[model samples]
Structures are given as structure tokens and as C-alpha cells.
Target chain A: MNSVLTIDSAIVDAIVAHARRDHPDEACGVVAGAIGSDLPTRHIAMDNAARSMTFYEFDSMEHLRVWREMDDSDEEPVVIYHSHTATEAYPSRTDVSFAGEPGAHYLLVSTREPDSEEIRSFRIVDGVVTEEKVNIVDATVDA
Target chain B: MAIEVRVPTILRSYTGGSKIVEGAGDTLSGLLDDLDAKHSGLKGRLITPEGGLHRFVNIYVNDEDVRFLGALDAKLNDGDSITILPAVAGGALGFAAAAAFFGR
Candidate 1:
């Protein structure tokens, strides 16, 4: 697997918007893509069941439905994202412990600053966190 | 007594890369035991050492969370479909303390 996340700029904007919109409360969501494609094509904003500024958990039922839909579509969550309202864009101890999807890109968006945002991505597997490069490409450009 | 169990990507290693597997039991706990017999270590990932459901793992029976249905004692029908998913949870806060506070 490549150690970089090449996603559409539009998706990145949407994610940032979601994070900012839900500021003061952690926002979480998933970007799914065709299985083994390593390309994120769909953005799904999910509810933070915890709804706490310090924590985020996807609503269990919503998680089930989205996961089932992905299964039916032969897709996987390429990017699992959550915002940190007060901290930097890095995985915390809690995030690492719950990093179950080894193949996914764990994207962290820190909305700590009102006028700016910090975005980073990582791969957490077996309790190890490896930061990866994020390559935002224009959607209108063909690869 | 055939129940179809849908395995998540992370847990598919135990299922030999098969997304769906079959098991038999009258209760959710019994079904997990049955699966462990075949998959070996599968139950360990879903159930904690204390035999309770792992907080990070979520098991649903026919779209209903087993946690609300007596957890391990939840009844299972022959045609019931079981879906195992790792809960997507975390935060910037100290999770050890957060977990204790939330009783998760």
C-alpha cells in the first residue's frame, strides 16, 4: 500500500466544512471507495454519538447502515476522519486503541484555530501510527 | 440452526478472508462459541477476557444491537443474520479517563 492519501480537493473541502460546522463538538465521518481501489469517491458525514467536544463516536445504527451499504457496493472506508476541537491534528491514545481498520487512512482535522484548520492523515495498525502524505488533487483533472 | 455471520474487514483474517460465515447456536454467546470453535480466536476479538462483549466491538442481530437485547443472552433464530463491526470511536481527550467517565 502506498504511504500517501490522494483525495479530491472537493472531498477535503467538504470534510473541513463538516468539521467547522460541528465545531465545539467533534465531528466524525467516513470516505468510502471501491474495494482495493485506494481511491476515496464518496463522502459520508456521520453523527457523533458521543457529541462531546473531547470525544466522537459514530451512532451505532448509522454505522451499521453505512457499513452494510458499503458491503453491498463492494466498497470500503478508505478514510475515517474526526475533528479535534481543541488539539492538534494527530491521533490520540484513544484513536490509536480503536484503530481497527488497518487499511484505512485515519484523517484528523483540527479546528482549534478559528481562522485556520490543520489537516493530517495517518495509518494506525497494531497500535502503531504512521503519518502519511495527503495529496489533494483537483476533481476536474483526470488522472 | 444456520446463522449467517457477516465479518468486518478487520476481523476477516479470522474468517479466512470470507466476509460471511455460518454458525449455529440458540443464543448470541453460544453462537460466538460455535464460531470460535471453527474460526479459533474469533470470539476472543469480539468478547473480552471477562466474557462480556468488547466495548470496541459491536454485534448486531438482524439490525438490532444485542446490547439492548440482554447482550450475551440475546436469543438467536436459525435465520438470524449477525453483523460484527468495530466501533468507530475516539477523541482528543484522555481516552483512559474518558472511558472511565463514560463507563464504556
Candidate 2:
């Protein structure tokens, strides 16, 4: 797997917007791309079933629908993102223990600061968390 | 009765990279046992040592969550389809807080 996440700047903006909108409650979603393709193209914002400021869970039925859609489209969840309402942009013990997608980029957005946000990404596999670089590319610019 | 079971990416290792595997049983628990016989250790991943569904693993029978269908006791048919998915969950809560909240 690549050591960095190269995502569109627009998707970053959308994720930040989602975090801000959910504010005290954690927001969660996924960015899907073609299977085996590290590139993320589709941003899907999911409901936080827990709806707690300190926790987030994708609704089960929604997760099923999203997974089915991705299966039909030959896409995989390239990025799985959630917000930390009162902490830094890092995966906590809970996140590590529940990290099931070995190939996904686990993105954490911290909305603790009222005026600014912190964004970071990591690859969590087998209970190991390895931080990765996030490369935001301009949509209109050529890669 | 042959039933098709869809394995998620993480659990694909247990299925030997096979996305879909076939098993036969009259109930969800029995079906898991049947698959475990061929796949080896696959059943432990879905069911805990206490014989309950793992908290983070989700199993569905024909699009309906097995939790609502008597979980392990859920009845199965000859051609029913089963899909297994790991729950997508986490939080900013620290280990202690998370354990307390989840009753773990």
C-alpha cells in the first residue's frame, strides 16, 4: 500500500464541512474509489449511529446499502473518516481496536478548535497504526 | 441445501481469498459450523467464546440483519444468502471511556 493519501482538495473541503456541521457530534463517512486503486473519487457522508460527541458508528442498514453499491461498482472504501470532537486528529484506542478495513486510509478530523480544524490520516492494520502523509491535490490541476 | 456466504475483505483470508463460499445448515449457527468445518477458524471470528455474535461483526441473512432474526437461532433455507461485514465504529473516547460505554 502507498504511504501517502493523495486526495482531491474538494473532497477535503467536503469532509471538513461535514465535520463542522456535525460539530459536537462526530461525523463519519467514506471516500470510495476503484478496487486496488488508491485514488479516492466519491465522497459518501454517513450517519453516526452513536450520535455521541465522543463516538461514531455507521448505521448498519446504511452500511449494508453502501457496501452493496460499492460491490456493484467494483469500488472499495479508499478512505474511512470520522471526527474527534474534543481531541487531536488521531485514532484513539477505540478506533484502533475497531479498525477492520486493512486497505483503507483512516482519516481523522478534529473539530476541537472553534476556528480551526486538524486533519490527519493513518493506516491501521492488525492493531498497528501507521501515520501517513495527506497530499491534497487541486481538482483542476493535472496530476 | 447449499447456501451462499459472502465474505468481506478482511475476512477473505479465512475464505482463502474466495469472496463467496457455500455452506449448508438449517440455522445461522449451524451454517457457521458447516463453513468452519471447511474453512477452519472462520467461525471463531464471527462468534465469540461465549457463543454470541462478536460485537464488531455483522451478519445478515438475505439482506436482513440476523440480530433481528434470533441471531444464531435464525432459520435458514436451502438457497438463502448470507453476508458478513465488520461493523464500522470508533470514536475519540479513550480506552477506559470506551470500555465503560460499551460494557467491555
Report the number of clashing residue pairs per model.
0, 0
Q: Number of clashing pairs, model 1?
A: 0
**Per-residue lDDT tens digits of candidate 1, residues A27-140?**
999999999999999999999999899999888899999998998899999999999999999999999988888999999999999999999999998899999999998883
Please state the i-RMS of candidate 1: 0.8
Worst 10 residues of 2 chain B by lDDT: B95-104
lDDT of each: 0.92, 0.92
List the pairs of residues colliding in candidate 1. none
**For every candidate, what share of the true interface contacts is present?**
0.77, 0.82
Q: Write the per-residue lDDT of candidate 2 for residues A9-30, one digit (tens) a residue.
A: 9999999999999989999999
Docking quality of model 1: it rates as: high
Candidate 2 Cα outliers beyond 4 Å, as residue runs: A140-143, B99-104
